[model samples]
Target: MLYRPNPPISFTGAVLDRADHIRADADKLAELMNWRARLLRLDGLDPVIGDDGALVWGTLADAGEHDELVFLGLDESGRACFAPVSPANKGNPGPANPRLWGAMASLPAGDLATYGGARALVDWHARHRFCARCGYTTKLGKGGWQRKCVNMDCKAEHFPRVDPVTIMSVEWEGNLLLGRQPRFPAKRYSALAGFVEPGESIEEAVAREVHEEAGVRVRDVRYVACQPWPFPSSLMIGCHAYADDPAITIDKTELEDARWFTRDEVVYAMEALKTGAEDGAFIAPPPFAVAHHLLKWWIEQ
Candidate 1:
């Protein structure tokens, strides 16, 4: 599917992502430790507090010496900035929680994803302060990879999480199935989606979520693509499914309305928004949204 590339940072897994992986490693970043955790107050920068209640922008001092891989947060124009931390007057600047700064969801979407990972790590540390088994506070271990319980008797380790969900555009006859939740804005409908439960396959999730959310029976479910949705972290698995029938039964609790849209109508709604046409009546999601991707594929088909 082709559309304008969403800017700030393209989260799509592609050749460009190779650079991200190379940069994701914090080991190489330690080389900058001498410059890390400098008092931004001295530099005329007032540190901001993040959503997690931690003052943002601290040097990753805990990151060992001579490392060069530093994960950076970029602005809308792709200019990168050092996420600074607290304890500025001297000494090792206290670790500032960058995660707290990530809550400004209105920022550009690419920054949201980048800082979302940072915040997820910080949140993980704050929440896992203690071991579930021994109640002993844990320590950040393995270069922010794991949290090890401090109590020797009940040592426990925890890792970052990414919940997986299956989202699908169901097709039957010549119409594409779409649904609108009560919370959706007027004229907004999106693909049916639900988290993949333990022991459930992607195909199973597509079939199950379709039936549970819309009472529609799916015949064949095929995986298309996936996106990293980091609103507290979730991997959205996109798919296309064939519905067995055209009958609609609404799951009122989950969706306000469930129905089918002809490919022409989908195209009209999108093109209307694109060309500023007068008669275009439908409202689709933003270009960055997975719903837009699904619609792009549908219209192309």
Candidate 2:
């Protein structure tokens, strides 16, 4: 049996309608203050979780005074939604879940999408407290979707950014090329990935990344899928590319190792990782990752 996890966060679930025009309306803003509206509380980037392995949401009344709240659109039922960033609880006492792993633990699609979006937005806000153009403090605007510099002389607006990354599984003949970064766990290897440089198309980025990191030329760059990677906001564009040559010249500065793996090796590695086998020659990315799906697609072909 083939193992496939739920679609990556931000790609699944129904997000609220971003009612942009009504955001500035006083009456509509007041309507969000109703007690029935839901609030997602975050401590830094981590969400507050409940005992049932779900995000702990509450009404506006339950929010802390110091919380920085952002309107996160209305749900299908028309209930207003907001996400508040609170100070990190040092002790993380009682039911507070860890960031990444906790979020992946069987969360409902709606909650996962909400958490992913909130984390990205709050992260941007934290990093962009001051404007780059004039070095003035910025204020939130457009329901937290944008920030504007406070300096009257040079009021510059800033918006949240999602960095695009091209993650590709390069195949040569019957084998796939996988590499491991220095930061990766021992014996683990996955697809080659790099940030999409400005002015470069997605296909161009894939070819350049594979060549730059492994000294392998590739062609036929084909799009597979995309995932919202909210570790400081990245959109992972998955692809498959055909390698022109099998030889690999690893860039030690970028990767610890780069090599080709046979089909059987990949299949066994995936199976081992899925079954929680402690000992294995190779370990692939977990099912939640786009790399895993890329590999699965390749294996099924």
Candidate 3:
């Protein structure tokens, strides 16, 4: 079931949603002020983790004064939820303070989705505090979902956005094409990806990215599963394509190296990445990324 449709893909199926009942009722908004509601305290953009490698969910009593309070959807148990951004100096700490990727891998599917949504929403609020039309500050509305400008003359509203990116695995002549960027870790390589341009389709973006990076033309672009990559906020559209030509012509600007690997080599690299073996000449992206799932699908094929 490696490529199964419902395999716990990271940041995908969020159970706690904004149903019509919850949105229309005024009582639901009062849940944020309740003492029993769970709170996820973030230090700037980083989440606070406990000693057991899980995100620390605290009550109102445990959190310090926060700047913004975002209503993250309820948990699986149907409890009210909120994520408050603590001041930079007041973050909770434990034995280790891991970043988003590491914390995501250790969390359950529901928690991961909740955290991703909260992070994206919180980041949007942090970046968009003022209206573009007027120089007036905006106020949170719709239970922290919308921001409206305070100026009576220009009441501009803003909503959160998720950038779409196309990530694909290109295959030709029984070999898969992978590339490494200059900033990537030493000896690590993964699927090719690029942002979708204005008025461009996902399939076109996949083919264009493969050609632009590796000088390879791809066709038969097929849709695969997708992941919500919430680094800042992006929806990665996973795909699989077939390369028409196998010749390697690396784009020095986009990638440090681009080469084709046989199925066996890819299989070995995947195993090494899973076991954290450093001896291998090639290392795959970590399992938390959609690139890893793309590689895993190719290996299963």
Candidate 4:
């Protein structure tokens, strides 16, 4: 069965038509890059919002001759949209202003989606400027969708990569498994997660990560929902399972703390989402995070 998350998800509902058909057609793409083309305004990966509380856009004229263009998609009016990635940000991004969160939260859904996709593509191009197979320099191709090696002998093409990660809620009796990494805010806890390694299915990854991090065995692994986390690009795969036993032996290398929370405790945090109440066992993740939605799905069960 397909997993559906309520309340929708951030970065999922993009309004642009990602006209892939034109990406490889140089002539067709050039035709779209006329005066009507729109350019997203980004400051070192952070968004630039207009006074109207929407993502600010400029024109192709703003692009510098050296700027590498990433085709975002076509806007509502079928006008082409693009983002010019500055080489200064290649493999390096600045720390966002603290208020970036608020700005992103206020953006319209479609705008947010456009920004996420554009950000991922631009960042990828910046970091992967060389052929992995031959150690030769590479240049943008396929309308920024791919990179081609300058060395004809090693013409390896590269594409944007989205690493798969497994984040899951494991249940025993009526309690849910939650953990806090060292970097997490104090008194905040969420689902256990780890990268999905090669040679494993989602079910295997969920089971393996839960065991490795919390020393707990799980069964009846199942899918829940997923989120596109574009912090350098990752796909957060959410899942649910039942614990064979609730005893947790924390892997300090991976987590600062791991424990089980009662259903009532999770219920309390969900309530805190609206009330801003901090007296609960631990602060639930923000509404936009897949972990928060996974907890919501858990309590509904």
Q: lDDT per model, in order?
A: 0.59, 0.79, 0.77, 0.88
Q: Which whole-number lDDT from 0 to 100 does residue 55 have in model 1?
A: 36
Tens-place lDDT digits, model 1, residues 100-219 = 233332444433444445444444444555677888877655445567787887778777567898989899987889888887767877888898999989999889999998888997
1 or 4: which has the higher TM-score? Answer: 4
**In model 1, where do residues sit more than 4 Å from their true spots?**
1-10, 13-32, 36-113, 276-281
Better of 1 and 3 by TM-score: 3
Please provide, for model 3 over 1-301, each residue's C-alpha lDDT reduced to its tens digit, 9 standing for 90 to 100. Answer: 3376435678877867654355435587775457777888666667677787666788766666655566776666666777764434332222123355577778777667777787777777777778988989987766667788999999998887788999999999888899998988799998988989998999989988998888899999988778987767789998999987798788898899988888888888899976877876589887777888888887777
Q: Estimate each model's TM-score.
A: 0.69, 0.88, 0.88, 0.96
Best-matching candidate per lDDT = 4
TM-score of 1: 0.69
In TM-score terms, candidate 3 sits at: 0.88
Task: Tell me which of candidates 3 and 4 scores higher on lDDT.
Answer: 4
lDDT (tens digit, per residue) of candidate 2 on 1-301: 3434445433346467777776677587787778778887665567777777777878888777875567888878888888765433222112223446546656777777777777777777767778999898888776678888999998898998889999999999889999998877689899999999999999999999999999999999998878887776788998999987898899999999998999998999999976888576589987667888898888888
- TM-score winner between 1 and 2, please give it: 2
Best-to-worst ranking by TM-score: 4, 2, 3, 1
The prediction achieving the highest TM-score against the true structure is 4
lDDT string, candidate 4, 1-301, tens digits:
5657654777788899999998999999999999999999998887898899999999999987889998887888999999987878764343324466686568887888888888888888888888999999999888889999999888899998888999999999999999999988789899999889989999999999999999999999998988887776878999999997888999999999998999999999989989999899999987777898899998887
